[model samples]
Every structure is written in structure tokens, then in C-alpha cells.
Target: GGPAKGEGQATGGCPVYSHPAQLTDNRNCVLCMTCLKACPHRSVEFNLRPPGIELWTTHQPMGHEVALLFLLWGAVLVHRLPEIAERLQLPQLLARFDYHALATVVLLAAPGGVAWGLYQLNRLGNPCLQGRPFVQVAYGWLPMVLLSSLAHYLTLGLTEAGRIIPVTLATFGLATAGPIWVAHPAVIAFLQAVSLLLGALLSILLIQRIAQQPWLRLLPLHGMTVGMTVCLYQLIV
Candidate 1:
């Protein structure tokens, strides 16, 4: 033989089946085929080589839900701004009436509506996005949409009625209670933080369920939330 070749054993890092004892650590594993035949759990399988079963699951895919969400949000945006077909910076289209009101609604509603829709869409499709990414994106976008919408209405509020609030410096002054002056900074911060945390948690839980039964997912809940918030703004105004 070659120099020092016979001195090294060829342990090929493969299971050897020369004897039944070599296949299992349990000494009582008789070489009977009965155990393999009768076992329902399939806890033991004879794999001469590891296969690619780990990469596959029998669960169904639901990518359609994501697409539906996208469509729904698109429809909402178009519905909110019926003049979108005109005010899209098209030179010929801009000859009509002003689209500023429609543009304002779209600007206020589109971001959150689009973000929520996308979050739902991703959850419908992706099992892996069920955790932190969902939380972060949802929390980040929802409040921006909501608070900005509030600001929009607040502007309207100021226009509808003259400045009902008088300027005063005393701590007991009632002027601080109205929109003429901003609320206490601490109170605003607390409300914003709570809303963000709740929105994130709510989205995560919904997506977790969607991961289980994608067919059970629906758009009514999202639509209702959007509608309700808009209604609340209407009430506030």
C-alpha cells in the first residue's frame, strides 16, 4: 500500500447496518419487521440518507389574500378621492374644478389605509413576518396616518368656529382645555404611546391566526376600523 495509507481507518461518517444493534441505541431493538409495521406514530424510520422532508409542510398557501388587500386599499383611496383621475398632475385633466378637498382626504387616509392593508396582506401570505417586523411597521405607520388625519380635522375645526379659546397664562385658565392651545405634552405622549402599542399587538394577533387558517381572513374588520375612525373624526369636527 501507499505510505501510511493502511494506518488510517475509513470511517465514512455514515451509519453502518452490518448488525441490528448498530442501527439503534436500545439493545432490545430486535431485528423484527413487526415493530416497523405495527407502529402508527412513525417515530422510527429507516433513512439510509437524510432527505429534504424538513423543507416542506402540508399547509396550504394563501397569497391571494395579500393581493385582495392591495386591491381593497386601492379602491378605498380611489373612492375617498373620486377626483384622483383628474388631479394626478395631468395637464389636460387639471382644467376641471379644484381637487384640493379630495386630495386632502386621500393624503390623510391613504397612508394608514395602505399600511394596514399591506400588513394584512403580508400576514395573509408570509408566516415568517408574523412577529417583530409586523409590529414595527404597523405601529410606525398607523399612528402617523391617524394623528395626521386628526390634524387635518383640527384645521377644519378651527375654520368652522372662530377661536373659541382665549389666551391666558394662569394654570387654572380654561383656555388650555381647547384646541386653541395644545394639550399638556405628557398627556399627548401617553395617548400616542398607548395607541401605537395597541395597534401593533392587535395586528400581530390577527396575523398569527391568519397563519393558521388563511381562508378565515376577511377585510370587513379592517374596513370597519378605517370607517370608524373616519366617523369619529366626523363627530369631532
Candidate 2:
């Protein structure tokens, strides 16, 4: 017979009804791949698509999920905090506190604080949005957040990933030439910049689509997104 039924829906071991779009809902998925393995007909298939498309399309994030996004954003900031602090001439201030403790605070607070402040400005500028949940509009930042994280890590991937070749060869006591094909610093920087630019553009478009308000009213949110992109570009590149 076919797959067993649970309340009339196929019991495919998916908590979210095996809905492709809902799979993009990160909070509900543990990435276990049980649905794929459990499907008797091998009908489940994973396809690649544009990154962050679900943010503007079908992902309806809740308040806690929005908080999780900010947490991830804060992690990006924490990863670059040393450079940021030095650039801001806060090295002395940073010295007084334990590095791990400070990073903990930044990881917990920075993004959420900035997001909350921007949310207030958004509400003030767009009075019509006062009744809407902040989480609803905050989804607009999803693209920027995801792309910025990717760009931040791109540096390590481009510069360090090539070392695995030599490292793997040396691990077996074999002679090695060197890193196979590391990207030039300039090229890596350029790619990082391009990634941030794309993220900023997508973020602005998403904000406009989500808000559906006058351009003037949307300026604060747009400014926030652009400002973050600029800050991340400076830190990462």
C-alpha cells in the first residue's frame, strides 16, 4: 500500500506536512532529512534556488524566529569585533573587559538593540505600520543578514580553503607544493564587496515591498539597511 496516513495527510515523518516552502522555515526544521528518507516513492527532491528568496516570498517568521535572526547577525558582528573596536579606537575600553564576556554581550545585544531602534524609527516614520508586529517587517533584513554572513565567511573560504590541499598531503607525509589556488587578496575583497552590494539591494527591495509605504516614510528603514551594509563592508572588506 501507499504511505501510512495520519489524520488524512501522508505520514512522511515531516513535522511541517512536507511543504517545500515551509521547509524554509528554519525554526521548524532540524535538517534531519527524515522526510526524504521516509518517502516511499523517492518523490522528495532538494533543489537549489536563489538565496534569501524565501525571506520575501513565503517565510512567515514569528517574533522568536526574528530574534534568532538577530542573534545570528550579532554573531557576525562579534566575529569582527576586534577589528571594529580597533577602528573605533575602543581598544582601551575593550581591554578592561574579558574578551569572551564582551563578545557574549555583543552577541546577545548589539543586533537586537540596533534592530529595535530601527524598528522604532520605522514605526515613527510610517504610522500605518504601528499596528503591525515588528517581526513581520523585520523579515526584510533577512537577505542582508544571510548575505552578510556569507560575505564574512567568504574571506576565510577564499583565503584558507586552499590550504586544505597542502595540509591533506602533508598529513600523509607526502611532499606538497603549496596551497593550490588561493584567491588574491584584492579579488577576495572585490567579491566581498559585490556580495554586500547585492545584499543591500535585495534588502532595500524587500523593505519597499514589505512596507508598501511612501518612499519618504521608508527612508529610515532603508537608511538602516544601507548603513548596516556599509558597516559590514567596512569590517569585512
For TM-score, the strongest prediction is 2
Give candidate 2 misplaced runs (Cα > 4 Å): 1-58, 93-100, 125-131, 176-179
Q: For model 1, how big is the CA root-mean-square deviation?
A: 23.2
Per-model TM-score, in order, reads 0.25, 0.75
Q: Give lDDT: candidate 1, residue 223.
A: 46
Query: 119-231 in candidate 2: lDDT tens per residue?
Result: 78777765655434567778878888888999999978987797888888888989666657689999989988998999889878887777666677778778888888888
Tens-place lDDT per residue, model 1, 1-237, is 112243323342223333333442332344555434333443555557322121122222234433343344334344434344444545442344555455555545564465566657756765553333433323322332344344334433444343344433224465454545444545544454444344434444443343333433434334444454443333222
True-structure RMSD for candidate 2: 4.8
